[model samples]
Target chain A: MQNDIILEATGLTKEFLGFVAVKDVNLRVRRHSIHALIGPNGAGKTTCFNLLTHFLVPTSGRIRFNGVDITGRSPAAIARMGLVRSFQISAVFPHLTVRDNVRVALQRPLRNSFQFWRSDSMLDRLNDRALALIEAVGLAPYAGLPAVELPYGRKRALEIATTLALEPEMLLLDEPMAGLAHEDIDRIAQLIRKVAADRTVLMVEHNMSVVADLSDTITVLARGEKLAEGPYAEVSKHPQVIEAYVGTGHG
Target chain B: MSTRNVGFLLLAVALVAPWVAYPVFLMTALCFALFACAFNLLIGYAGLMSFGHAMFFGLAGYVCGHAIKVWGWPPELAMLGGALAAGALGVVTGALAIRRQGIYFAMITLAFSQMVYFFCLQAPFTGGEDGLQGIPRSPMLGGLLPVHNDMVLYYVVLAIFLFGFGAIYRIIHSPFGQVLKAIRENEQRAVSLGYNADRYKLVAFILSATLAGLAGSLKAVVMQFATLTDVTAAMSGEVVLMALVGGIGTIFGPVVGAVIIITMQNYLAATGEWVLVIQGVIFVAIVLAFRKGIVGEIADRWRAYSAGSRK
Candidate 1:
């Protein structure tokens, strides 16, 4: 079980000035599992997620990924190591076409991003792969359209496609279904499950149904501390988890 | 029209402009046009608004003027020296300026450029108030062709302009350009995708400064003098105006903007301070009526028309 863990966090804590946003918490995500971090608003889930991705420095913690200590690494360095993250807000380059947005991500691992002298036509070689990613995200029809013009749901899909272009070993999605309509939520939930088949996914989400359907392991948090952790069937019935959710007025 | 057709048309117009227009005036416009185009590279594509670009432009002019006047270096070497000097300055300034974004970045650049301006005002080699005078246009092609003739010098400036402009066009269409645009549109997203956004911005800054230097060197050779005006903050504002009026992001926009502005300056020489008022009015009008700029607005309209026609 220890060897199966791809990402492990020990005693992770974050504080804003004097107020603690996330208390000492330990999280271990096994390889190829869809792990969900669910909490009501102000539950410190986003803070924990930000700390893990190094967007915010952990007040005190040790983060190990694939057996290497990764706490204090820059976000780009962490991403380069295949621990890519997606923003809660859809993060696509608005001026670039959907295909170009994915291509920009694809260029990162190739290490040819500084080749300014080469014609962009040289990037045409990535078109087949880029289009495949677009199709996978159900954005093939909008491949050539500027991402700024994309509808809200489609923009989120493009963000996922861009993140997937990195081909990460572990993916951290921050509220992957935030602002999504009901129909779009179902599509994205299905998309997330399909992508999770080959990779580890740790997500912070408020939508419990999506969590129950996709998460193999569920961790519940409230007021900056973990409340419960188990398979969804077991964790959903935990009295403390129910009380925390209900107490927060989210029941 | 297709981009290829536009390219051909521009090339044809450039080739024939010298015969129809005053060669000296045309050369002056070409030099400024290159300067504005280089300025546009940073502000338009990289989303960096550098307020001290004239430091590169004026400093390169001083370097090229000194090399030609005192060292008697060949014309091409002098220009290359100026460009390389400006590129090195870019690396130093860009490293500092890129640490801040938006208005702070602009302020830092402005401060650094002002320092350069003061240095130029007091530096012994720069001739202070008198400026570097009578910079000779030396012979080219191993002394086979002399640049003493205005027409010959015009061709040289035109060739340099085309080369510099073409280089910028190529960069904007390259994979590297795509990443810069990504950084411009959403820097945080670009970083999440593993791009070192600051490094890319620095490279772009250096490239823009190098090209600006190239234009400045050409201007020094053409005018046969490097003056304090070249390094002034006003020069920086002028380049920005050209880029904005022509179209901030469009390929040929700055060139068009430069020509219009330069021609206005030439014709309105007798208007004295009214010229400033006219320029301000034009800027205000551009901001209010067509914020995309002349070429940008035209391009947008063309796209809309084409889309409608297809429908």
Candidate 2:
């Protein structure tokens, strides 16, 4: 039923200087699900993520989220609608304390964006919630640290905490497990599992083990076209996916 | 110790200093301090370099001058009118200027400000060569205080300066201010996290311009005159120098820069054209050796030494 759709893209196309990055693509993300988008490099996965989240306007096609058409919306508007994205890079206010970073993220949804007239104590309650999110993400110890001063892995955790503060119904994570050490990836995988308990998480991951372990559903693409879609075990054995990954030796 | 403690100490000194210093000189420093602090809002906190801010300053001055002289408006109303007009101008100019980024943004604002300067030059109300002269200083708010008393006017200017400076400090500490700093540090990251960076920038621009206008409007009242010279590119350069010399990002730096520069200007009033040369050298020195300026360098030193001692 249409009610199951959290996000849907129909006939989406993207081009850069006449070079086709995505062509005649269709995708859908179901409600309250962990959907993994896996592909080789230049598979247009990142471009697709950008298009769906309103970071980049599609050349043509329509995107609907939460049963409403969201084409041509600003990223901020889309996010305000409870659709949020964490960047491939650490997307945090590095100069601010971790608690402040989460508070800034929460400020948008709280409609406290321009409350310059209000006293600081009125906002302390918001920081308490931010601290709770920080603790849930195991960042309680680093909560007072400036985002930039924290270790690399901690910054990523802070980014997740900040994103969660937006109270998104759906989260688009771009390479959440990338560049993480094996042990750190396990921790991040556990965090993603915890986050996924409440919200729909659509993540683009290169790590096959993470994709296998966390995803309820997996979609594989090679060269901008859908190769296969299923649970992880089925897709891992798909001939085209195996051929794509085996020959490239990069993903 | 803490900058807040130091700020309070300075505030106390400023409140009591009319006995020791010339009222005119003290008032000039106060006006310049407010102006510098307002200018720092965009550059220091928002990471926006607005080369066209002098347009706001000059426009407000001219508007206040016209309102007082032609419309015969009260002093408070005239200053408010000036600030409102400048805020309106800021909205338009900021929308256009913010379409560009980095050095291009700076150039766009500079170009737009220069347009305001040319408009003032040809506009008939500005009085062209002589400017609006022999302008009367209106009475204090609601005609409560006599206009002719020097120390009373000095205190009024100081109060306004303090109010403006306090507003800036509060804004910087607010959540909105933190987001602005985030946008300044990494705009793409801010966008990815769902902030409308352009909107934040425009709001900051308007706020900065309106406050700068308030400074100019007060200046017109203090000097009891408005001139084309106030809107000139040199005035723009001078405010930037003050911010740079005091500290580009710190709260107290610009005020320090403004006070020091005003003091220098008074002492060098007897010398011909030396103030400009001296200020220019200070700018070079700030950019070259003291990129943090007087306040930033001191703050950095204190932070570093404190951390070191704690360790």
Candidate 3:
């Protein structure tokens, strides 16, 4: 069972100018499970996500992916190791067309991203896959449009499509439904479920119903500390979890 | 018109330019145009505003001049040597400059260029304030074609410009160029997608510096002199202005910009200090009235019109 743990963090802590943002937190994500990290605002969900992806270094901790230490690896390095993250702000290349944005991501795994001498037509081979990913994210209609012109929901879809192009083994989605309307939330939730079919997924989401529906395992945080960990059926009924959510006005 | 047709039309115009205009003047404009195009690769495509690109242009001119005058290297070899030197300098400067981004990157490049300027000012080989003068235009292909004549030199300069410009065009349309654009649009997004944005930027810087060096080397041969004015900070500002006026992100924007600015300089030569004031006014007007630059504005309007027609 221990070998089944794909990504493990032990005693993760982050301090900013003598103020602790995340403190002595441990997290274990099992192979092919959808894990959710949910909490009220300023509960250090984003900070914890950054630490795992190496956007922010943990003050003291060890992170292991596939049983190898990646505590100090860069975001790019960790991403290359198949732990890709989507930004909370919908990190799509705004100036690029939807097809081009996906193609850029697909180019990374080909290891020819530095080959400046070759024509971009060489990457036309990726068009089929890129188009498929775009369609999967329901952005086929906007494939030719620059990402900047995409509606907010479609832009998030494009971001997911680009991230999917990386073929990551585990994905970290930071607030994947942030700022989404009800219909968009449903669509994106479905997209996330479809993508998680063959990979582990770790997410920080504020939407409780989405988290309840999608997460296979849930970890609740409060003020940078882990408050509860279990399935939604068990964790939702915990007294402290109820008190924390209600007290923090998250209810 | 199709993009390919537009490109062919531009190429045809360039082919006939030297015949219609003064060959020497046309060659000089082409040289500056190539220089501006090289500068555009960094600022326009890669989103790096190097405030000291003159270091590459000026230093390469000095090196090419030295190679021609002292070492008596062939014209091709001399220009190659100069471009290589500039590429080497780019590696050093880019490594340091890419450590910081945005305004800091610009400042670092500017500081490095200033240092090179002072070095050129005092260096024995650079001829101090007098510059490297009387550089001979050697014959090409082992004396198969003499380049002392302005007509013959124009062809040579034209060939070199086309090669450099074609290479830049190829680079911008490559998969690597796609990644560069992605980096420009969202560096963090590029990084998360497993790209080392700094490394990409450094490669772009080297390519740009090498091409700028090629332009400078050609300019030295055309004019038969490498002067301190080539290396000055003002030259850097001029390239920026050219890119801005033409359209920083457009393929032919810098070339158009170089043509306009160089033509203005030629026409306003008698106006002395007024040339600088007029350039300032043009810059202000372009920034306020046509923020997308001349070519960019035209491109936008063309797209809008075409879209409307489709409807």
Please tell me which predicted candidate would have the highest DockQ against the true structure: 3
TM-score between candidate 2 and the true structure: 0.95
Q: Model 3, range B37-110, lDDT digits (tens) per residue?
A: 99999999999999999999999999999999999999899999999999999999999999999999999999
User: By summed lDDT, which 10 consecutive residues of candidate 3 chain B come out lowest?
Assistant: B1-10
Interface alpha-carbon RMSD, every candidate: 0.8, 2.0, 0.8
Candidate 1: list runs displaced more than 4 Å.
A248-251
User: Docking quality tier of candidate 3?
Assistant: high
Better of 1 and 3 by DockQ: 3
In model 2, the number of clashes is: 0
TM-score of each: 0.97, 0.95, 0.98
Query: For all the candidates, what are their Cα RMSDs to the real structure?
Result: 1.6, 2.3, 1.6
User: If both were scored by lDDT, which would come out higher, candidate 2 or candidate 3?
Assistant: 3
Global CA lDDT computed for model 1: 0.92
Across residues A123-204, which tens digit of lDDT does each residue of candidate 3 receive?
Answer: 9999999999999998998899999999899999999999989999999999999999899999999999999999999999
- Supply the TM-score for candidate 1: 0.97
lDDT of 2 by residue, A12-102 (tens): 9998999888887888888999999989999989998999887888999999997799999888788878888988876778888888888
For residue A83, model 3's alpha carbon misses the true position, in angstroms, by 0.7
